[model samples]
Target chain A: MRILKFLLVKEFKQIFRNKAILVVIMVMPVIQLIILPLATNFEVKNIALAVVDNDHSDYSRALISKITSSGYFRLSGYCNSYNEALVLVEQDKSDLILQIPPHFESVLLRENSERLFIAVNAINGVKAGLGSGYINEIIQQYNQQLRSKLQVPGKFNLGPTIQIQSSNWYNPNLNYQLFMVPGIMALLVTIVGGFLSALNIVKEKEAGTIEQINVSPVKKYHFVLGKLIPFWILGNVVFTLGLLVAFCIYGIVPLGSLITLYTFVMVYLLAILGFGLLISTFCDTQQQAMLIMFFFIMIFILMGGLFTSIDSMPDWAKMAAKFNPVSYFIAVMRMVIIKGSGLYDIRGHLLTVLGFAIVLNAGAIVNYRKTF
Target chain B: MHSVIVSHLTKIYGKEKKVAVDDVSFSVDKGEIFGLIGADGAGKTTIFRVLTTLLLPDGGSASVGGLDVVKDFEQIRQTIGYMPGKFSLYQDLTVEENLSFFATLFGTTVAENYELIKDIYVQIAPFKNRRAGKLSGGMKQKLALCCALIHKPNVLFLDEPTTGVDPVSRKEFWEMLKRLKEQDITILLSTTYMDEANLCDRIALIQEGKILSIDTPANIIKSYPDVLFAVKATNMHQLLQQLLRYPERLSSYAFGEFAHFSFKGTPDTDGLVTYLEQHGLKEVMVKTADITIEDSFIKLLG
Candidate 1:
């Protein structure tokens, strides 16, 4: 108990003394919560457009007006020729370009023409694809209107005859925050759990106080536990803070029980912190720890499904992710928040995390055992 | 009575190739100040770590206060105080906080054993609220000593405690150890500083994972088996070369301003003066030099 007290006081003092921890634990999550969601989105907006309208007809003007009026794009300039439109696009002044033929209305009226030039920037591939699809849908609507005037059979239908029903589970509105908050919570915990704990332990080793503890009456397990427990609790606090901020700011309420979420969080924290302790055992300096942690954080964020789905990965990578504790935690958080999954739904994840906690920690203890 | 004892202690590190502590064995009597004096990587810290129960020797056994370091590691830890070479107190914590934390860890309060560390503690007690990381090297050293002694352990292991500290603080720290000795607690210290060997009741001079000699400082110096002389001349570097060329010289090493040399036979000052003059050496003076532990170390290495 005294060892525990001593370690806790020391850990708390270190957290306050070091502004780096404050920045990572407190400020970063908030900034990422607010800014990342706003910046990193699949939804495309504010597309700059250039038009090459050689037809000089009412129909082309109306089509250009329709494309520009959707609030998704702005008409940046009117090019006199296709070359000017191409130049604008190559210069990065416009993201998309539309070209009309010299006899656009005449050709449409004479032979029901089809080839139309729609150039879009593929640098942002997903955005370009979605924007082009949106434009295609608008032009299809315009064609339907023209067909109605021409008295085409089965035209001008307000709705499809084959009806399809859609339903959303858990978060029925499909709020982006509802999907992101839990992952953010898991990510925040990992940064605190994996990086901070490793650096903290390795720093003590570098400073030589580790020798003091080695010689003290404190058992190796006691010293390791003393260090791990405080950081583990701090990880929980940061996780909870992330949860609360996500809820208050974005209305991203968890569908599962808070107790259940925090329970898995607690178990997940052990595996993460154990991994950090294992890293500290192998590393001699804080700089080395930091470099290794940078790699860990990158792997955690990428494979943990923060921005991509692990299921989409190749067979080997997907199998490898099974042992990743970050993946399990992120999966559990998503299951609990988005699917309203009960404890039974996440039992497999819990067992995996528990296995990791036991095995990794045992490995760390064995590797660091002080047999000279 | 022996407070610390070991038998044929050996530690080999890699695949049966490297021996960090090879067949090393020594004992420290109760209430005595013993030193393991050696240069860096001479296995002093390894010996200290093994004795403190932080490490288990590969092929030998050690007992402190009659408790085996391996079998009774928990009890051994409870009985010893260790100050590692590096300044390793919780840098974020204030001086008072670091003291209290370590004191509480040993199940004692600082107030209970204030007398044990009062002299060193009082020096930095005025700035008790200052963070340990922000304090000077000397203050950190004093605080580390206070922390180590807070528990009032039966034995203390200080591993190269004054390696980077300034000379004055080093002097003060040794004086503090002298006072601690009067309290009748066994102290096992390690240092690379040869001058500090004199301060210990007995020192084991070690090099290359082997103990060259272990004895009282006076006895170790007394056992110099050669006529040692310090030679100085106008050409200091040339004078060293000239002294080494003499056929009767055993060993000659530059010590401070003069080159200390050992003789193989009778003192031949007149013959040496004639040889130096022939070598164009001016103001040649030869005197008996005090053999330091460093000289003894170099000779033992040779």
Candidate 2:
């Protein structure tokens, strides 16, 4: 017990003395949390639209004005023919094109129906899909207005109309930042904990100080705990900083109990730091440890449901996500922060992370040898 | 009583299993300073590593403080203070922190064993707040010695402690070891410097993982088998060549300003000088030389 105290003091002193580490711990979280959410937005906006109007009738102009006023698109060009609009799309000036055929207004007025053409540049799949969907919704609204004017006092009531109204729960605004802030906080905490502990022991190995420790009377558990506790505390600090950034900049506050969130974060930090120490035990140099950690962390982040939904992934990737500790933390963070979950809600996630902590730390202690 | 014991100890390295320490055996008595003298790659560090519980010996058995190196390694680790061939302290840590860290690691404090390391610590005490990496080579050696002695273990294993140190620091380090011996702590240190061998109570000459000889310095010199001569001339390089061609030449090597030469038969100082002059060598000089540990080491290498 006494040995562990001295070891912790030495570790903390070394960590603070290293200016590079201090920067990584204090500055990296703030920068990454603020910038990553604003940059990785999923909502597509400011789509450029080109209109080819063969019909210059009042109804045709009304439809064009409606599409532009929806705030999802900008009217980039007004061409007289489909060929002219195609040129605009080819020049990358427009993302979508709308073509109204000749006599479109007369046909709609006489036969009560007319067909419009929409050509989308399919190179950027997300932009193309969302842009076309927005245009279709606006045209349908125009048709409803025309039908009401032409209906002879809603004769026969169109055989009982059924209108379905759906509202988004948890996040009524569908604000992307609200969804991203919690996951980003989880990711930042993971990075700080794993990288710092991974490099800690290997630095000693490179400096040849481990030989002195190996020959001394310090027990294996004492040394491993000495390395673990300091970084664990630092991980909590980074997580707290992430929360402050979320509340101040993004105007987001957790709806759930703070106790539940911290409880999960505490266990999650243990599991990740244990994994880092395990890697440190297997490596002889800092470069090797960094490379191995990079490889694993990349996989974890991509599959952690941070940027991409785990539900949309392939079957094999989804299987891998089930075992990822980062995924569980992200899920718990979103649950507690956005949904106001209690301790009982995250019980399963808490237990799995606890298992990870026990297994990885045990492996690290066993692999750390006092003698060759 | 023996403080350290080894018999037929062997250590092989890597997939090729190259032999590093082969069938080597030695012992050190309590309160004695034992030195392993050899050049680089002579397995001096390997032996130190095995006895300090940092490596496992493949073939033979060894013990420290009457504890088996393999079975009672934990106990051996508790009783041994090892300073590896490399300077292994935390370079980013200050000298004082390093000293206290190692002391607490061994379940003791620097104040508890102040008497043991005071002589060495006081020399580096002024630099207590300075980072170890910023210290000079000599000061670094002193700080490493202090950390190793902070716990006052039963035996101390120092591997090439004075390899890159200055002359004055090396001399002072040997004096510190002498004082340590008076405290009844057994010392086993290795060095590449042949002159340092004379200061130890007993010295073993090692090469290529083999022991050439083990004895007191005076006794090893007294056991020289031939009368050696120091030969010098204006053209020293040519003088060596001419001496090697002499019919009675046993062995010849350049030593400092002269060539140390021995004969196959009896003393032939006059004949050697005449032979050198006949070979067009100028200002030839010859005299019988006293055999030092280096000369004896060279003779044993034969």
Candidate 3:
């Protein structure tokens, strides 16, 4: 315990002494929290839609008017021909294009049938898919209005219909901030925790202090543990601070008990600290440690299901994600925050994270003592 | 019992079979300052690491204070204080903090062992609040010494502790070690400075991962086995060329301001002076100077 205390004090002194860490901990988190969420959106709102009405009759004009009035599509331009609409899309001037067939008024009245063409920019697949869905809804609504006007009888004919009613729990509005805040909390904590611990040991190597410890009465295990615990606690503190900022600034309230959240976070920190220790042991310089950690953090965050859903991934990718500790932590955080799942519900995630912590720490302890 | 001991200690770094410390065996008696003098990459640091239990030898065995380095590694760690070649204390912490921290690590207090490090620690104590990283090269050297001695280890292993420090600091550091020797602590120090070899009770001049000579500095210098002389004249370049041309001059090498030479047999100083005058030289000085450890080191290498 005394050795642990000495190490903790040293770790604290090291962390608080660096102005760079102060900026990363106190300032960077706020900046990212404020700006990152505003830029990240999957709902595809406020799409810029354009239309070309070659059929200059009442039928085509009415269809165009319905599309323009729809809340989903923001009509920014009315082109004269297909070529002009294509030009707008190719130049990235518009997200979607709606074209009405020529002689649509004559054909709709005589034949009781008409066709409308919808061309969507597929460069951004998600935005294009949403735009196509919006245009389809508008055309269906206009056709229903025309049918009601030519009503035959009060009796209705039976037909097949498909409907999807999604009941989004906790965050019924599906606020992206609500989903992103917890994931970001995990990412920030992991990064700072891993980075600082790696630097702590590597700084020893750089300054030649590891030699002092190496020659001193302290055992390698004592040294490695002394280095790990302080950062583990710090990682938790940063994790909690980030959670508070999420609540205070973004109004993102966690539905689960804070104790459970903290418990999972503590377990998660072990894996991160282990990774940092491993990096420090392998690297001779702090710069090398930082670069290697930056690479690891990049891969972990990108594959951690922070912004993307793991369930939506391909089979092999999802299988790979199952082995990723970040994926489970993020999934567990979302489950608890959005669904308020209890320990029993998240027991699998807890076990996996616990196993990861043990394996990584074992590897770290063994590798950390190795001579360079 | 020796303060530190090793027998047939060999360490191979990798599968490629690079031998760092090869069948090395040495021991230091208690209360003695021993020098392991060598050039860079001469396995001096590797030997220190092995004895400190920082690295396990691929073969053979070592013990510090009667405790096996590998079998009783923890005991060895508790018994020794190591200062590596690089300045390695917590730079963020102040001098006092680093000293106090290392003291506490050994289950001891700075106050409890104040006498053990009082002299060296006092010199840097005034700046106790200043961070270790911000201190000057000499101050950092002192602070490292104070921290290493804080625990009052039975043996101290300093691996080239004064490598980059200024000469004055190096001199002062040696004086501190001389004082520490009174406390009966075993000191095993490695250095590249041949001058420092004289300060040790016994010195081992090492090269290419091999011990070339091990003896008291006086004895090593005395055993040069030749008639050595220092000769300097006007146009040293031309003088050196002429000196090397003589077959009677067994060896000749520049030493500071004068050229040191060894002759195969007794040479007439007047005859040599007349020869130099005839060769068109001025301001010639011929003198016999005491050989230093560096002189012996070069001779041993040769």
Per-candidate Cα lDDT values, in order, are: 0.86, 0.91, 0.83
In TM-score terms, candidate 2 sits at 0.92
Among incorrect, acceptable, medium and high, the docking class of model 1 is medium
Question: For residues B55-102, could you state the per-residue lDDT of candidate 1 as single tens digits?
Answer: 778988899999999899888888899888778888888999989888
Ten residues in sequence with the least summed lDDT for candidate 3 chain A = A155-164
**Candidate 3 lDDT, tens digit per residue, A193-229?**
8888898788888877777776666667778887888
Query: For residues A1-372, what per-residue lDDT tens digits would candidate 1 score against the true structure?
Result: 767777677777778878988888888888878877666665677788898998989889888889899888889879998788888888888888888888998889889765578899888887788888888878877877776676666667655654358999777886776777778778889988988889988988888778777666666777788789878888988988888788888877788888889889999899999999888888999999999989978987888777778989898889878877888988899998888788988999999999999998998888877331
Better of 1 and 3 by DockQ: 3
Error of 3 at A301 (Å): 2.3
Worst 10 residues of 3 chain B by lDDT: B267-276
TM-score of candidate 1 relative to the true fold? 0.92
- TM-score for all predictions? 0.92, 0.92, 0.93
Candidate 3's C-alpha runs over 4 A off are A152-170, A369-372, B268-282
**For residues A239-279, what per-residue lDDT tens digits would candidate 2 score against the true structure?**
99999999999989999988899999999999999899889
Please state the CAPRI-style docking class of candidate 3: medium
Clashing pairs in 3: A208-B88, A209-B88
In candidate 2, residue A169 scores what lDDT? 93
Query: What are the candidates' interface root-mean-square deviations?
Result: 1.9, 1.0, 1.7
* Over 4 Å off, model 2: A79-91, A149-152, A156-162, A370-372, B233-250, B263-290
